[model samples]
Target: MDTRNKKRLGAMLLTGIVSLSAIASGCGNNAADDANAGANEQPANAATENAVAGAGMKDGKYDPPITITYLRPWGPDVKFKDGENQDNNVHAKWASEKLGIELKNQWISPSTNNAFETKLRLSLATNEPMPDIISYRGDFNLVRELIDSGRFVDAGELFDKYASETWKKAMDEDPSVWYPYMQDGKRIGIPILDYAYNGDPVMWIREDWMKKLGLSAPKTLDDLEKVMDAFANQDPDGNGKKDTYGLAIGFKNWINTWMSDAGWIFGAFGTMSNQWNLSADGKLEYGSVTPGAKQALATLQDWMGKGYLPTEAGLYDETKAAEDFTAGKAGIVVGPHWMPAWPLEDVKKNNKDAQYKAYPVPSGPNGQAGRHGTSNANGVVLINKDMAHPEAFFTYQNYLFDQFANPPIGGEFEYGLAEGYDWVMVDGKPTTDAAHTGGFAPEKYTITFDGARIPGLNMATLAKLADGGEAATPFEKKLKLSTPQTMLDAAKIVLEQKDITMQQLFTGAPTATMQMNNDILAKMEKDTFSQIIYGKAPIDSFDAFVEKWKASGGDQITREVNEWYQSVSGGQ
Candidate 1:
C-alpha cells in the first residue's frame, strides 16, 4: 500500500480524521538557496556523461562528493533522535559516508495539513528551480503537474542504464506500475514499490465461534449463509443474547476500502464496485454499474433483512465497522492478511479465548470468487532533468533495493536500519521491541518513506513459509520471526486465489469528465446501492440508476478512461 493510505489508516486507528485532502496554498521561497545549485556548477551535458560513465561512483564512492537536494513532506508520525532532524539524520549520515552523496533537504513541509503539496505546487507555479530529486507521495495530479512542468528527465532511460538488475526485475514484475508516471512515451518517474497483494481481501472469521457452533469452513455462498445464520442466532459468545451479527461491513465510504471491506461480496458476483474493470470487449467500464452489482446488492438486502448486520452499518466507516468484530459483536469480517496484527488482535484483548483465522473468500452461487487486488506502486521518485548527477538517486535507491530491502543473512542491515533504533542488542540477541529500542523508525528518515521493497517478495515469502518451506533467506527469516502464523496462512490463501483478484485496469490520473462530475456520479452510486441494500429502493431501481449515470457523465468518463488506458498501454 502507498504511504498516503498507510498514514490515513494510522490516523484512523488513532481516532484522527479518516480522510484528508491536499489543499493548495501559497508557500515561501525557502528553497531558493539550494535549488539548482549543483546544476550551475557544471555543464549539463558533461555532468550527464560523467554520471553515466561513472555510474555516479568511482570505486564505490563519488570521487568528489556530490550533493543531491530534495523537498520532503514531514508528518507527525516521523520522529527523530534527540539531536537529529530530517536533514541531519542517520540515513543522511550513512549516505554521505558510504555513497559519498551529500543528501540535503531543500525544504521541509508538514504533510498532515497539505503544506508539502502546497509548497510543491507553488514551486511549479512560480517556475522555481527544481530540487535534484522529488519523492512525492501525495496526489497524482501533483505528480502529473510535476511531469507536465517539463523539468524532470525520462527516468526510464536512467533506470534502464543504471538500476541494479534486482531492482529492474522488481519493477518488471508489474509494468503497469509506470502507467501513472508516463508522459509522451517517456517514463517521467520511478515508482516507489511495496509488497503486492498487501491490500487484497481475505475472509477473517472467529475460529472460536466456528468451533463453538460446530460449523465447517464456508466454501460457497450457501455455506457462508448457514454459518452467518449460526453466528447470528446461536450463542457463539455464550452470552445468550441476540446482540451479535453475522458479518461486519461498512459502506459509508465505498464498498471497496482498505479496512472492513465489502468488495469481495461484489467480487463473488463477478464485479467490484467503485473501480474500473476490463470488460470482455477490452474496454474499461464502471464496476458499480455492472449487472453483477445488482445481484450483490440483492444479497446484501437479504442479509440486512435477516438481521445479519449492524443496524447502523450504512453509517459506519472502515474503522467503525471493524469495531463490531473487535468488540465481539460480529463473527466474520473481510480484510487483508494484516488484520490479525491490528483490529483482530483487539478481539483477543476483549475476550482472551477469541481465536480468529483467515479463510478463502466463499464462492458465489455460480462458483465465482474474486476480490480487489492491490497496486504494486505506491508513490514515485522524479528527478530534475538539469541535475548534475541523475544517477546518484538511482545509485542510492539501488543500494536500498539490493541490500537493505531484503538483507542477506549476516549483512549490515540483517537486523534493522541501525542498532538501538529499529533493533537493539538485548541479552545477546537482537530484538525489535519498542521498549528496548525507543521505537525509533529510521526507515521513515530515508528519501523514500519506507525505503525499497520488492512488490512480490513479501507474500511470496509468507506463502513459501506456509507451505513448509525453510526460512532460507534473510527476508524469509525476518517474516518467520515477526509475522504471525495466521497471517502466513492467510498469505497462502491470498496466493492460491491470485488468479481471481481483479485489479483496477485504469491507473492514470482522472479524466476530464471524472474531474468534473465524479463526485456526483459517486454519490449517485453510493446512495442507490445503500438504498437498495437497506430496502429503501427496489432492486429494479439499479437499472434506472445505471442509465441515468451513463447519461449524466459515466459514459463519457468510460470512453476517456479507455482512451487514457490505450495511451499508456500502447493499445494493448
Candidate 2:
C-alpha cells in the first residue's frame, strides 16, 4: 500500500493512537492526577510520570480498586438472575475481587439497529466525555469517525506490554486480522474474535420427509430439484394437505444471511450476492453482476414457477421465512450449523415426527458447490484516551482469553464460567445444560461482560470430534455436550467442503463513490432480480440492470476495490 493510502486505510479501518488527558475522576488518587502532581519536573521526567499514571502499578491487582466506565447496548432478551443485574454480575464481582477493577456503565441503549448508533452520534456531536472503554459489535464507520476525533487511545503499545502469549497467539491466527483495527501502524482497536466457520452455510432438510418420500439426500443440483419436486408435490408430510413447499427462503433484504440464506444457491453457480469475488481473470468483480448470478436467478425463477419455493418468501425476513420449515410446511432450508438451536429445533416442538438433518449444499452442474465464508473478527473494543488504566483492561481481557477461553490444566473455569450459574454439579459431575443452572441461567442473563470469543475454538473442536476424537479440552467438552449430533454432522460436511467456501475479496471500507451510490445500485439489483423471478420482468432486464450498475458508481467502486485488493495482496 502507498504511504498515504496506508494511513488513509488505517484511519478508515480502525481507531487511532491517542494522548491521554490528565484528568481525575471520583478517585482522589488517580494515575492522571498523580502524573500531573509532578508538573514542575523536567519534560523527560513528566513524560515518565504520564506513562506510569496511564498504566498504574502492574502488581496483578490494585490496592484500591479503579473504576472503568463503558457503554452497553442492552437487548430485549436480556434477563438478570433473581438478585443480579448488569452492575452486579458474577463477572463483575470476579474482576473486582481478582483484578481490583470496577466496571461502571455510562449509559445503555437498547440493542437494536440504529439505537446505539443514534445515542453514540449525539454523544459525539456534543463532545461529551467518553467512557473509559466503548465496544460495538458493528458500526465500523462510526468507530472510524470517532477515531478521527482523537478521543480514543492507541492500544498497540498497551497490548504489546500487557497481552499474554496465549492472547497474542489468538490474534496471530491471521496477522492481517489486525489490519482492520490498525491506524498509522498502531493497533487502535482490539478485535473481538469469533469462530472462523460459524458462517459456513449448509442445507437443512427434513430427514423424516425425505424417508417418507423415499428420496435420498441430494448430492447434485438435478437430484436436489427432484427432491424439491417430490417435497412440494408428493405431500411428504402425509397430512393429506397440499400445504408444504419444497424450499423456504426469504428475499425481503439481501440474499446472504445466517438463516435460510440463499448465498449458497448463487454459490452453486460459482458466484455469491452482496460481495466481491475474484474472477477467472484474477480481478475482484461484483458477484451479482456475473453471468453465473443470472443463471442462479433464472433457476430460482423456475423453482418459484414450479411451486418449489414458498409463495410469500419475498415478503419474509431470514427468520420469518423459516416459520414454514418449523411448522413442517417446508422440507428444506439452508443455514449455518447452529440452525438446530433455533427455528429447526422448534420443528420438533411443533411436530414430534419432524426429524431434520443438515447436508452440504448440493453440487451445481459444473460439479462444484460453494458457500459464503465468515470474517473472523466481528466487533472492536475501543478505549478512551482519558482512561486511567489501559493495562487493567488488558489484564482483564488476557485473563478472559487464558482462563475463560483457553483455560490451563486444573483451572477454575474448566467446568464453566461459574458453578451454579453456567454449570452446576449433577451427580457430582459438571453439566452445561440449562437444567442445572438453577434460576440463574447465566447464558440468558449475562451480567459479567460481553463481546469476546476465542477464534476457531468451537470449529476446531467439532472438526476433531468429527474425525473420531474425544473432547480433549474443557471448552471442547462443553461444546460437545451442548451441540446436537445433526449440527456436528453438518459441521463435518462443511469442513469436508471447505475448499468450496467463497469469501468477499474486498474487506476495505466503502469508497466515496460506493458510500454515495451503492444503496441505489443495491436497490436496483434487488428490484430487478425479484421482478424477474416473479415473472414481472424479462430475464433480459438483468443485462439492463448490469449496464445501469456500471454506468453508475459501480465502476468507480470496482476500481477502488481492486486498488484495495492489490494493496492488501502486496500488489499481486
Candidate 3:
C-alpha cells in the first residue's frame, strides 16, 4: 500500500518523503555541457562513416557513448542469484551489447502491492536528474502526474520513426493500448500488452470425485447444488472422512481477495466486477446491487447455511484459500489458468492421485453464467527529449517487445531476464515446469503472474487459451499436465461464452467518489455478504446494505462510471 493507505493500518514509520522541483524542458541544461559535447566529437572518426553507412544509417557511425537510466520494480525473488553481480542481469547485458545502451541501476523495491508506486512517487519528487527512459509499471495516477510535469518528451514521433516493423505490427494489433497513456493528445509512453483474456476466471474441480460420484458436469445453479452436495457429503476425498468442503473462497486485503477471488461465484450467480449484462437492458450494466447480485448473495446464504462452504472463508487470505483447495479439504475453486503453476498446484503434492480439472462455472438461474475480469494494457516506458539519435530507444524497445516479449517464432529472447533466475534449461530446453524454475523471486518465480514461460497465443486464440486445456506448445504442455483437464475445459467454456459477459469499460483512474467510498463500500459489501452467508445477518440486510451503498457515494460513482462508459462508446 502507499503512504495514504499505510497511514490507516499504520505499518511502519516511513523514512521520509522527497520533493522535486521543475526544471527547464530538456535534460540537465548546462552551458559548459555544449562545450564538452563539441570537444568530445573528435571529428566523428571519419573512417567510421563507411562502416555506419553500410549498416543502413545516414552516417557510418554515431559518436560518443550516451547512457540511459532505466527503472523496473522487482522483489526478493530477483535478488541476483547464482553468484551473479548485483549490477548486471540478463536484460542489462542484452541492452548494452545489442543496443549500445548502458542502463544504470535505479533501485529495486519489494514490488509489493503499492511499493512500486511509493518508490516511483519519491523518485519523481527528487530533482536529481531523471532517467532518460523509465519502464514504469506502477500506477496510472503516477503516469498522469509524470505527463503533466512535461519533463519527458512526447513519444508519438519517436514511435513512428524508430519502432521496428514487428513492434509496430503488435501495437497496430491493439489500438486501445494507447488510451491510458494519452494526455490531451500527446502519447507519453508505450502501452504494455498482456493476454487479452487475462481477466477470464475458470471453475476448477476435482474430476475424480465427479467420476466416482457418477455426477455429470454442473450446468445450472440447481446442478451446482447437487455437485456441491456431493462434494461436501459424498466423501470426495475418500480418506474415509467427512472433513471435506464443497469449495474454497477467501476474503482478504490482498489483490484478488474475496471480491477478487470469489468474483466467479458471484459471476456464476451473477455479480462480478462493475460490469454485467442486465436482463432488463440489452446494454451492459454494473452488477453491484442489481437483481443478479441479490441472487448471487442468496446462493451464498444457501451454501453457508448448508455448511458447503467454509465457515471461516470470510477470514481467508488468498494464500490460505488456495491452501484449502490444495489440501484436498475443498473439492472445487475458481482461478486463472496458471493456477496449476503456483497457488493451486500444491494439490499434486498434497494428494498425488487427486484429479483436478477446470470447468465453466455452473450456469445461472436464467442461463446467464459468466465470469468477470479486467484486461491489462498499461505498464511504464521511458521517454527522452531532444535526442540527437531519437531512434535508439524505440528500436531497442521494439526488439525487446517483439523478439523478446512476444516472439513471433520460438527463439531465445534477449529479455529472457535470466534462465536459471526465473526459468531453467532442463535437458537443454525452455520448460515452464516449476521444478526447473530455480531461484525465482520468493513471491513470484513460481507464479504465472510474473515472468514465467507461457505459450504462444493470438487474439483469436485468447478465448480458447483462457478456457485452458492441452498446452498450446511444448512449454504449455508441462503446465497442462500439472493442471487438470477440467480447469482447461472450464476456461474454454467461460471464454466461449463471452457473449453473456461484459468487462467493465472504465479502466482508468479511480473516480473521486471511488476514492472516497471505495474502501468503505467494499468493506460494507464483504462484511454484510459474509454475515448473511454465515447466518450472522438476516437476508434483508442485503437490501438495507444496497440502500446504504447508493446513499453513500455509490450513486455518484455509478453516474461517473456510466459517463465514462458512454464516452468510451462514443456516446452510442
Best by lDDT: 1
Candidate 1: where is the Cα deviation over 4 Å? 1-56
* Candidate 3 global lDDT: 0.54
lDDT of 2 at 55: 49
Query: 1-572 in candidate 1: lDDT tens per residue?
Result: 33234533443233211101100000111111111121122222233234556454665567688899997677787788989998888889998898788999888888876779888888888988999999977676788888888999999999888787667767877899899899888899989876677777789999999998899999998999999999889978999798888999987777787778888888889998888898888887878899999999999999999988777888998889999999999999998777777668899889998999999998998999988877777689999989987788877787777677667666677788888788899999988777888878787888887777766667766776777778766556666777778877887888788888898877777789988998798788888998999999999999999999999998999889988999999767
Q: List the residue pairs that clash in candidate 1.
A: none
Predicted candidate 2 versus true structure: per-residue lDDT over 1-572, tens digit per residue: 22113222222222111000000011111211222222112121122223444445345565578788887566554556767776788767877887678877788787566798899989999999999888765566776777777888887777766666556656666455655666665778777665556657789999998888899889988899999999989988887888888988987866766567788888889998878898888899999999988988888889999999988878987778888899888899987666676657789888897899988898889987888876556567888899877666776666666566545435767776678776788898877666667534343222222323545455655655555667656655666676667766776676667778887667666678888997798789889989988878878888989999999988889998887766656544
Q: Scored by CA lDDT, what does every candidate get? A: 0.78, 0.69, 0.54
TM-scores, one per candidate: 0.91, 0.85, 0.75
Cα RMSD for candidates in order: 8.5, 10.8, 11.3
Q: Among all windows of ten consecutive residues in candidate 3, which has the lowest summed lDDT? A: 15-24
Number of clashing residue pairs in every model? 0, 0, 21
Ordered list by lDDT, greatest first: 1, 2, 3
Per-residue lDDT for 233 in model 1?
Answer: 91
